[model samples]
Target: MPLALNTLKRPGPLSKGGMRITALGGLGEVGRNMTVFEHAGKLMIVDCGVLFPEEHQPGIDVILPDFTSIRDRLDDIECIVLTHGHEDHIGGVPYLLKERADIPVIGSELTLAFITAKLKEHRITPTTIQVEAGDRRSVGPFDLEFVAVNHSIPDGLAVAIRTKAGTVLHTGDFKMDQFPLDDRITDLRAFARLGEEGVDLFMTDSTNAEVPGFTISERDLTPAIDKVFTTSPRRIIVSSFASHVHRIQQVLDAAHANGRKVAFVGRSMVRNMGIARDLGYLNIPKGLVVDFRKIQSMPEHKITLVCTGSQGEPMAALARMANGDHQIRVGEGDTVLLASSLIPGNETAIYGIINKLTDLGANIVHKGNAKVHVSGHASAGELVYCYNIVRPKNVMPVHGESKHLHANAELARRTGVPEDRIMVVADGVTVDLVKGRAKVSGKVEAGLVYVDGQTIGAATEDTLAERRLLSGGGVVTVVALLDPKTNQPVEPLEFLTKGFVHDDRTFAGAEAQVNKALKRAKDDKIDDIGALEEIIVDAVSSTLRRTYRREPVVMAVVVDA
Candidate 1:
């Protein structure tokens, strides 16, 4: 058993006997789950994750939690604790290590393996401490215990952070699955033990707080998988998130049971399953797995293909296959099973992909048609059960939007937790724990840091806004070589437009209007290039908006000779 909260060694009490908890991200949002536990000068960070960009965030690769709070205080950081191996929970490590490479990273064995592979891509090799449930590690003034928690990914853990002042329990993205596929339950006993120690502050995942009843277990998916494999006469193509090893295990087992050879598609699917198999989390029957190179020789009915793109990511394997752009193709008589959850914003893309496959004469099976995917976050009933179990003095929800957080707090209040003890805060709000009493202390400087191609935090919201504008309305570049002495154009105006209707007559009229604006500026004796450029910009913007009902980025350049 892991050491109890108060059993860990404490060197000395801090001058200030309180720990400040700041939510850097994952409050009032779905991803970029991070939090800081700071006591005196020692600080421990948790779950440095990243959020995928939405349609509004054009050209942004990923969204990160702002690092300004810990940039200068990097030396004070004890360590970074990871909860699982999902992209949202571990994607920001490369960005974080760029600033400081020596920071020790701690997580489960498979989690560390995934991180190590990602770090190698960035050419970083840092000190790693591999931990598991019932394991305890001390960092600075904080003693941390990894409590096993069941989630979408294997080896997920909830953290029990013990300090001289109080104990803070953080549930890292969990759902209560009584009979998980792997039989690794959520370790409710540990939570009960922590409750006995008297939890000061409890932060639980609120991703599905509004959802009712308990989430279906992964074991319940076995029957569905068996039916798909048993009935399908053609090739079977399965699409799911690459990190979901347990789901992949069921697919592999079903393929083997049905005498079908398995082939893993998608880069992430292959790599992540390889790590899981090597780390002993995934059990693949030997000789049941085959390479894509030999899949052609095997009969279509004897093949089982596991791939990515369950959320309809454009470049993922299943998406490419659906468009006939990948090596593996899905066609007539084949069954394409999207054995994954449909994320909130991906319904349009996912349905479009399903429609395309159906058009191609393929049978589609998804959550809408069958019992396949189950959520990894606890629902309202499970949340009530957890609140009753941990029995924390204060409850604060994490890893969800405003609605989810509000629902979770209300659930806690109804479950006998004090209404006032529940802190409903957004990103950057800090909750301070002083001598076992928790309250909202103040706010911190926390926001999102966007990651674009080859740059971190360089792509701000303003940059994305300009990108959206150009993408929607297109761009026009107006240029003129002006005679320095005449303060007038020496050449014809140059216009470049994209994503806009290309009509020579329309542009000719707009160009003439712009020249008229420039001529008016010259009559006013506007010798300054900046002033003259502004006149051309206003004229062109007004012309385009009036004619085309669009506002484009107008660039006017007056090159003086």
Candidate 2:
């Protein structure tokens, strides 16, 4: 067993001490999820996920959890456990492995295969331990067991972690599906068994807790897709999360039954399909799958293209097709069915694509008034069922926004859990369980980290705010050359503004304000350059706010040459 986590090795003794739980992300909001469980100085992290960018955030695809708190103590990390293969839950694995590639990753066979494919995409593969439902394994001082749970995707699981303090059940993203397509359902009996063993804490998924009823099973999506395939006369296009291999299989079956050949596009869809087929998780008919390069030659009525970009991701195949940037453009007579609902905060981008596709003369189908997309999270009844099965001493809700957390808390209380036993934690807050009671002990430096192109570091809320400001307000720079000989201004101050305004627009008023500030400062003989810089920045900022009601970042350059 590993003694201490490498990510926590150098940090000073924690204030709470003993076994503590820190939610890196997914506490206050949905996505970019990570949770740290530290006991006896041994740390094990679960589900390092990434969040989808909001509408205001242009060009950014994902937001990952900051790992700085755990970076230095990776040596003591026993293992990295995964809940499923969804982007929000598993997207950060590559980034985490890039930092420390030696850490062992444990998950279901399908989950491990998916992670491996993702790692290979980044060219950084790590050691994987595949643990199925009912399998028990020990990592460091923690005893881990995988309990099967049904969700939109196959192989979704809730992890049962037994530590020295007590047994904690980390319910990964899950829904209680009675009529799931797969044979493996959430083993309520097993969860009840754990309850009998006396679980100290239960961390559950709150993504769909606020919804009134139980979520529709993944099988419910088939009839919707089947009707579209059976009725559409032209080529059909279906887009969804690539990790939903079962959904893809259902689409394939529907298309084949309707006498249409299916082609998988987008790099992610192709890669994941390959892995699913290889692992015997997905079975694709020999002639059903074809290269998109040969798509033009096939009859439009006989073709069904299943691609990515259901979230309106910029580089995804569907986005490229909608934007007319793809090699095979979306043309007339194509029936594009948006089988996925737009995630909250991505409505503008998704609608933009919808408009583009419609403008190109393709008929569009959506969930605007019909059941096209189904959530993979449990509702109140399902949550109650899981609670009744687990019956932990304490309840903690993870993997959702504040509203979901509040709902989950209420559900736990209504289900007979004590009011004092339920704890609501925000991101970065650590909860300590001492003698079977849980309370917030302290806070950790946890936030969002943007993994853009090649850079990986902390990109907190402030940074994202700055990005939004820069995009909207633009930037301004003022350069003044102060003559050291006479300590006076040599010439008219050079002012430059890019992205602040249009080419023809005149900022003469703003420029005059800066000049006036510089002249006033020079007359006073203000030798402190830093103070002068601040004054000029304030002047420009205040001017912009008055004129445009906007605040753009101002950089005042004082060069004494």
Q: For this target, which candidate reaches the highest lDDT against the unseen true structure? A: 1
Q: Show the lowest summed lDDT stretch of 10 residues, model 1.
A: 1-10
CA lDDT of 560 in candidate 2? Answer: 83
* lDDT value, candidate 2, whole model: 0.81
Query: Against the true structure, what is each candidate's TM-score?
Result: 0.93, 0.90
Cα lDDT of model 1 by residue, 12-59, tens digit: 333388988888899888888889899868889898888877677777
**Per-residue error (Å), model 1, residue 63:** 1.6
lDDT of each: 0.86, 0.81
> Which residue pairs in model 1 clash with each other?
none
- Residue ranges of candidate 2 with Cα displaced over 4 Å: 1-18, 458-463, 475-497, 500-505, 527-537, 548-561
Q: CA RMSD for every model?
A: 5.4, 4.6
- Candidate 2 lDDT over 7-41, as tens digits, reads 33223454443578888999878788889999887
